[model samples]
Target: MTAVVEQPPAQPKVKAGGGERGLIDLVLRFREAGILGALVVLVAVTTVINPRFLSAQGVEDIFLNASILALLAVGQTLVVVTRNIDLSVGSVVGLVAFVVGDFVSGTQHGVLVAVALGVAIGAACGLVNGLLVSFCGVPALVVTLGTLYVIQGLNHYIAHGEQISAAEVPGAILSLGNGDLLGIPYLPLISVAVMLAVGYYLRSYSSGREFYAIGSSPEAARLAGIPIRRRVLTAYLAAGVLAGLAGTLWLARFGTVVADPARGWELDVVAAVVVGGVAIVGGVGTVYGAALGALLITTIGSVLVVLKINPFWQEAIVGLLLLLAISADRLVALRLARVLRKRNVRHG
Candidate 1:
């Protein structure tokens, strides 16, 4: 003990800006958290204004209304996550719904056949989009926009001023649309199941993770040997199939088919994607966020109607939300830049 030298006071261990960077990452990574908070606030305020807004019927109506849009948003997420867009989804839905109605309108063509046909039609549309974008290297936006027009034209030409009414829709198909278990509506259930499955795949699968990689940096992904074209093609295929499935579900739920059932809905789907935190420039969002975004929009519409606000205010509100998302994204980017700069200096 007498021979022991006095040790210098120990310096406090530090990870530099670990805590600050962690907080930053948490804020950036949990982008959907903000959306969830907004939803809770919306529900609370609306429920306070109108007790019936929380009524069972009102809740069911909101979920039912949101189901199809949620599905569209899910598929749109796949495309968007790969730094691509699918503007043709709405037209694809319109096309598939009419096709399903035409195929199973009167005869007992059964549920399976009608669904299969719609899915196939959608797959074809997706394949075309994929081929052009992947092989020809055309911009996703341009290819999808062109396909949207073509599909819309084809749908209208096929319908030729005709509509399919509930009476003509098969009972089997309608049953799936309207049926439920334990008092839960099938449409919302199906939409939720689809969202969960896609969400799981995106979060857990290697291929799915590659979608984000591609979106994050196409050139880097190619250097990593990620088969960019194939992944992009598959994304389009999945989107088309979902759109087709949604089309059939659309017919089932509404029991009425028109030449343009989902016309102008592409914008809503994109809005939902953006609102859900999926960057329009690409790589940063989740399907769950997209689904929530869809649900929130539908809920907001219901709330506004209950509150007796001017109908015009709805679109304006949505536009404001979009702007907020963009602004938030900009803020996040700036934060990351600052964080990296600091880390580099500390290591330098």
Candidate 2:
């Protein structure tokens, strides 16, 4: 009889947990899930309250309206994930919108050239912000806040109290903003495509993981040889580009641009990013969640109008939701701290 060696026992793979604990773990591990849940609830409630809310036209309008904010929110998500913020997005949007409008309305420029110029202008602004924050080591919040004023001032001076009219806008440019493809509005479709691309990159790429690492612990990320400066700079650049794109969409949708278009929009972008579950402290969120947050906020405004709720109450409701989101974040952080402490004690 031949002696046969017994094969080594197979190693058991660790399985992730499931059920309510799993759901809680999911939310804690990825805060975006909570924002997504809130979005679902908001949609369901609105649909129940007004069955017409589910109509195709209504859906399209909601998405189209949300697209501009969603684009800015995507950039905000990237910056916030790296424990940074950009307070100049609103101004960037306004300035870029005006630039694009001016170009298109001028006798000298074509639609393509105008669009290119608009995007480049936005990118340049972002680069300046990045240089100040990353190279000069200025705080991001301060740098962006200053840029906010600078850009807004420039916009006002350039416009000189004038607004571009719909009659002056090019047909091609207008179509790009207001037209639809395969039944989906162009603006929303563009936003969806961008969100998907950015989301994938953040979730699937090594550099993206580095962003999360930096946000989670800057010191550790540095020790691990991650290029923190480069990543941060790149984040700002992406933000500028997205802001430009949003500005373009805005011009098309509104069929004009004024000096102060999208004023106070930075707060809306920040709120969407935070509400989508990106921790204020940094290193935890998803673009999809942020987009959903934008949708929810936009829907809330529309729903309020439809329900005939007092305009003042809309702000109050939004404030309450924001408060709840912050509270949830704190609870998760505390629980995580307790878990780590218990584990340390056990190890000791």
Candidate 3:
């Protein structure tokens, strides 16, 4: 008899679309890694130049300064991922800060009440924006730009040229802004928590994925049965909510609010989002990347100051970085498309 029955040949292991996903994820990680590396190099060089830059106080200052901007950037990510923009966020923040400050200072409202008021005001503003853009089919840029001025006008009228002094702010709110748990500042902690939550939601949820789909191709997503309007509305609502929260935090951190607090901050928020890998064209970006981008921008400002560089150069440097980031993003997207096509053909 034969020594043994012939062994059956093994079938090739199947991986489904694992290779494609892996490649896509690798590209995304590469973008984030590049930003992180830049941040490290910048920090290291600046620290070497000024040892004070690495001191505990200096480090805290960096995180503190970046926290609010990072929060705003995270909110902007939601809207940008949906192929929309919220130019009025700065105005919303300014309005909320002043209103909330005035309300809190004159009344006996606690932190919770002040925060709720801020959120409500923000939601109302967001609702107007969502309705206009989603239902009316208005261009987001034009709609938000209009709202920006409207909100600013309202803020100034309400302010009546008045400002909320530090004495007017509540102790609890100030504590929330400045106090720390263990060794970390509350502001940075809150910013990180919000970033992680939004990042997880966008990465893991089906609805979150739909935002990207709509942004990538509205027609395709619509054909696929996604409620594009609702999703867009939700994104705007979220951005408004976060802007409101940021406004509250702004009050806490600064403890003084003028009619035009955070004026011109919208540009910085957009810049951070763009630099963090969120395409201005939409559909591809992560909250994590956006937060890091905010941190990088904040660090750049600090570095310039520490190195005694001209303040005007900070804007120039940010603009240069923004250009480089956009170029990198476009290149990566093209490479990813090519890879996907090759994989599809090979699989077929």
- Among the numbered candidates, top lDDT falls to 3
lDDT of 2 by residue, 15-46 (tens): 22244235444774466655667668877898
Q: In terms of TM-score, how similar is model 2 to the real structure? A: 0.88
| Candidate 2 wrong stretches, greater than 4 Å | 1-25, 28-33, 106-111
Please give, for residues 107-211, the per-residue lDDT of candidate 3 as tens digits: 657789888999999999999999999999999999999999999999999999999997878798888889999989999999999999999998888888888
What TM-score would every model get versus the actual structure? Answer: 0.90, 0.88, 0.92
Task: Please give the CA lDDT of all the candidate structures.
Answer: 0.87, 0.83, 0.89
Report the lDDT tens digits of candidate 1 across residue range 1-348. 579789977543212257554654476458778888889999998899789999988998899889999999999998998889999999999999998898887899888998899899989999999999988999999999999999999999999999999999989999878888899999999899999999899879888888887887787787677889999999999999989999998999889888988998898888888899887777678888899899888888899999999978878888888788878877876777687778788989
TM-score order, best first, reads 3, 1, 2
Report the error of model 1 at residue 90, Å: 1.0
- Candidate 3, poorest ten consecutive residues by summed lDDT: 8-17
Question: Each candidate's root-mean-square deviation in Å?
Answer: 8.9, 7.1, 7.9
Q: Give the C-alpha miss distance for residue 81 in model 1, angstroms.
A: 1.4
